[model samples]
Target: MAKVGRGLPAPKSKRRVKYGPNVVRLVCEDLASGMTYNEVTQGRGRPSHSSLYEWRRRYPEFAEATDAARAFGAEVCGDRALEVAEQATEETVRKAKLEVDTLVHRAAVLAPERWGGRGAGLRRAEPIEVVFSVRRFEKVVGPDGRVCVREIKPEGEV
Candidate 1:
């Protein structure tokens, strides 16, 4: 029988240890510093890429940080979109108001008794219907105390 000598009673099986914040921070910093996943794993010696990926997935702090960064990016994009929308709305409202004012002024000048003089009750003009195929007009109150569009019927047309 061949004599098989046990080598130093075989080293005790080490318990699997969860890495602490410091280790995770070090790995994250290394990654941020342009170290690849393979390089980080090789340098840390304690964790493999798969294990590190799992830890990052399981860790709440890491997940929260990632989510926060993503939210910030989204917020920036949303703010830009909001700014553009606000500007366009302002311009549209300004243009609409100007058009309404010009039309009112012309009506007042042409038919002072119908539109400008005292006791000049509500008078309907020709029903001017504008069709917008691409854009729809949103009914909005203007600074002037009147509706933007007042439907007017043609003279003597019931």
Candidate 2:
């Protein structure tokens, strides 16, 4: 048995599925349509989640394609949220609000650069100038042998 994590034997699969272009295409298309990875993999003949991840690790192009698909999916979710909100009836208003909230949250997480809240991806650095004054107290022995305090100011200031 092949060793997996922490010396545990890898689970045996009942079937071996081969990776192919068709699988990639199906996954990307379904994902672009707003289907979750779990949902897409649940279809018949679809690669298992583990297998899909393995393929991603082994293939760079697959990873890039899936990433783009997910971003597109995020936009789809945003659109769906709008549709849900617009079609909400008094009876279904609460349910529609919840659905819209969930979709918006998903879009924010999936494509933060576009749908994330303020400060998600847009930030500008500006120079800040700070001005301050410092006062120093010095203890002095006066001619009367009594201690006196005087305030000393920093250079370039009165």
Candidate 3:
């Protein structure tokens, strides 16, 4: 029978799981290996998201490791998707395609601005066409040295 919180349960500080140093390192490695949170927890003493978040906040090294791992994981996903797509078997072609597509989508979501869907700066907007007609305006100067001129903005703004 474990006591609650050591002092009537402080609450947020309550640790859901106790993760050891080696396990933490393994967790980081697993993450870097492109394992999802669920996969990481599969056999390595399943820690909740809150526990992971708390660990990251408490340990700067963990935070950095997690960030790097996630980035690497995203890369792994992209690479695996490409590989799977290229070498899909006939029998599993459909399944492989779906898996690859999912991986690609996941990679995009993980790093949206860099490898995301639709691209970083893509947006939905009405299609527009611009027509340009070049016209030469000869300068006309009066005896008083007054010249006729008009300023042109990029979009024909005056």
Best by TM-score: 2
lDDT score, candidate 1, position 38: 66
Clashing pairs in 2: none
Q: lDDT, candidate 2, residue 72?
A: 97
Clashes of each: 1, 0, 0
List pairs with backbone clashes in candidate 3.
Answer: none
Model 1 bad stretches (over 4 Å): 1-17, 64-158
Q: Which residue pairs come into collision in candidate 1?
A: 125-152
- CA lDDT, every model vs. true structure: 0.54, 0.88, 0.77
Regions of candidate 3 where Cα sits further than 4 Å from its true position: 1-21, 44-46, 89-91, 117-158
Distance (Å) between predicted and true CA of 113, model 2? 0.9
Error of 3 at 26 (Å): 1.1
Q: Write the per-residue lDDT of candidate 1 for residues 1-158, one digit (tens) a residue.
A: 75576455863343443778766666666544434456666632456766767876888786564344333333343344445445556548766555555544444443355435455475657788998744234455678866675345456755
For candidate 1, the C-alpha RMSD (Å) to the true structure equals 28.6
State how far residue 78 of model 2 sits from its true place (Å): 0.9
TM-score of each: 0.30, 0.67, 0.54
